[model samples]
Target: MRIRATVAAVTGALALSALAVPAAQAGEAPTYRESAAAAFAAAHGTSDKAAFSTAAAAEMDITFSNFKIAQAVKVGTTNKVSTTVTYTLTHGADVDIHSEDFATGPYIYRGAFDTPDNMLFGDYAATCTDTSATTATCKGNIDVYPADGELLNAHAGTWKGGALALDYVTGDYADQGGLGTTLVQRYSKLTVNASPEPVVKGKTITVTGKLSRANWETFKYAGYTNQPVKLQFRKKDSSTYTTLKTITSNSTGELKTTVTASVDGYFRWSFAGTTTTPAVNATGDFVDVQ
Candidate 1:
């Protein structure tokens, strides 16, 4: 299968805003519906998790239906088939199997809590499990819990001209059988995806980069909206910043900045920015030509 890295888009500033303050701030992490929503979006972006979940369910016959091991083939031998095969053989005999299944649920995620907290009980609505030759489906809420070892953190603010942070707990389990360990992955860094700064004098060009869930922490309940990222720039040769720009990032975390070049001296430019909405923590830098 062709694997593509998925980028989670924060559609609005509100999503990032949910993680503005660390849950540890008030002796607990601050969470809102918006942050939960962001976390959900981030989880959906990880293709591996989704694929693993789908693959596991099919092999386990945990879906609505089950598949019988109709045939088995050995690499060099043809008739060495057994009446019944182990779970390892059904999925991939030679391949190392992990996680019994995959699931994302429970609306509320706490950053400060060391373990799972059912702040907002989440009910699974449906499940789709597919194999190369067979398909299965499950109706109604499935009994899914946060995988073990799942780490949840909240980071708020703007990084590189866009709101960036870990909204809430989002992760993939080594197994989805509700027994495997959960792995919390970081989203992409919030970025300003603009082209290189122009070198022409008085020719101000926009600066931008891309944002990902790894870069920003978010929540699963709250929806995100566009928010401005913080940026500071100065001439490489000069001591002080030549210009400071506050630009808003799109749903994809793209920012543009206009900057004019030096007319007299040979100059290089550098920039620094953050997406610290309620607070400033996430920061980044970029280069612009003379």
Candidate 2:
């Protein structure tokens, strides 16, 4: 298997609106309901904690910084993945965080939190080590498996993450309520191969390979079909490799193409990558032209 290195930065902006009206106002019920619905949808997995009211959620301040994960995750491998995230939480001026705090932590996941179909993979918990009154460092390993059955294609590509939520005691004397924040997550992997090393100058040289991405469900690499890949060649003692042709992979992630030998040179397959998977280039195979 041929390997390539790729890096991607996942980031998103957090928006918070100030509350102008008082919580006791009866007209604010609709706004609270809408906010509650949105918050509930973004929560990772299922939680017994109640959704935070709009007023309560607005008062809760949470920010995630220095979030990082593995640059390359291999397919068909049980990778021990680690992530670090810094969090700061404050309960505005009127709310006493210590008085109402019951459960507080971060939740990380890959895929759309609201859409079940898009929520292909995830890890809900990471242990937090406190560093200050409202700040802490969170770290943990996420077990990524390969996707099987209905979710086979869902495994490969950039997995979005950085979802952090805080659970607190609410109600009259502090019961249970929580809210969530959003961040970016990305993961990608690739593979390649070549054959028929010796050939005549005028004879057609056949090249073949495969394109795959990591599957978190089964912890394996699965075929990424119908994707375009570039065939390139570098002449003997030459510094640069030029693109020869473009071809697409088949259903099994197989890639194939042909080129006539001109001189002693090297041949390779390159993938530009996708949103979920990182870019990769196969090792060159030297062909001796007679």
Candidate 3:
């Protein structure tokens, strides 16, 4: 990425001219060469500033271990994902991890480093336990809701975990400095089944399904219980699905609901996922109304 406008200008000038000039005497008036030199200095000065910021951020030693999220986060769903972070701050001596100077919080950030846009998907304040003079363990819950306007929702896939160094902020503004680690985000899966095919018109049809999400610790899919799910239906030839009612999952993440058969249509389930898991929509189950 371009560091600054002055850097770009100096770069172009360097490409056009290869000659080098000595610094002008103190009594001599400034010339075009001095202007070019100033531009070059401005460009390197910006780089030095960035390097200093990075070094300062590095001083706040942060690490993530045993960081676990119960399930995969679904898009558009508000999931409360739990996290555990360990950190240590070294500034000459061991700095207090709990000090107000450090804005130590758990967050999910986008993987791209090309630009400083909406890199943060979810950020949550954490409660830390001091483990040593320079180290601490923090635990907290992050509420992740990736809606249509959210950048994370635009890209449905894995997101990495990290910690934000809010301590670098001054007044209302703060440079975004955080340490990112290798942690993969999980995605949720939902399924639906409609029974009593070829039912008479106006007859009650039973709809059942399950809501399960990926478990990073176990590397398996498990039922997500006590969560709300929506039952939607669409006519056979219709492209849109309308919500019929809301249902909750049982202890096993099993879903059951009943709807009256009106016409040949498809039945499905849609889950607005939580912070930990991404949102999911089940495939439609078609039923022919006799």
Best prediction by lDDT: 3
lDDT of 2 at 61: 57
The TM-scores of all predictions, comma-separated, are: 0.28, 0.54, 0.42
Model 1 is weakest, by summed lDDT over 10 consecutive residues, at 158-167
Which runs of model 2 end up more than 4 angstroms from their true locations?
Answer: 1-77, 83-106, 110-152, 155-160, 163-195, 215-220
- Could you tell me the lDDT of residue 255 within candidate 3? 99
Residue-by-residue lDDT tens digits, candidate 1, 175-260: 21121111122322443333344355556555554333322212221212265555555445655544355655566555556655
Model 3, position 53, has a per-residue lDDT of 44
Q: Would you list the C-alpha lDDT of every candidate in the order shown?
A: 0.29, 0.48, 0.53
- Model 3 Cα displacement at 71 (Å)? 17
Reference-based lDDT, residue 59, model 1 = 38
> Which 10-residue window of candidate 2 scores lowest in summed lDDT?
1-10
Model 3: lowest-lDDT 10 consecutive positions: 1-10
Report the lDDT tens digits of candidate 2 across residue range 1-290.
11111111123311111121112245433232222223443232222123444345434555555555555444443444333433444333443344423333333333443332222122333456656666656554333333222223453454444333444334211112222222222233344444466788788888887877655555566787898899999998997989999999899888888888789888888888765566788888889999
TM for candidate 2 is 0.54
- Candidate 2 lDDT (Cα, whole model)? 0.48
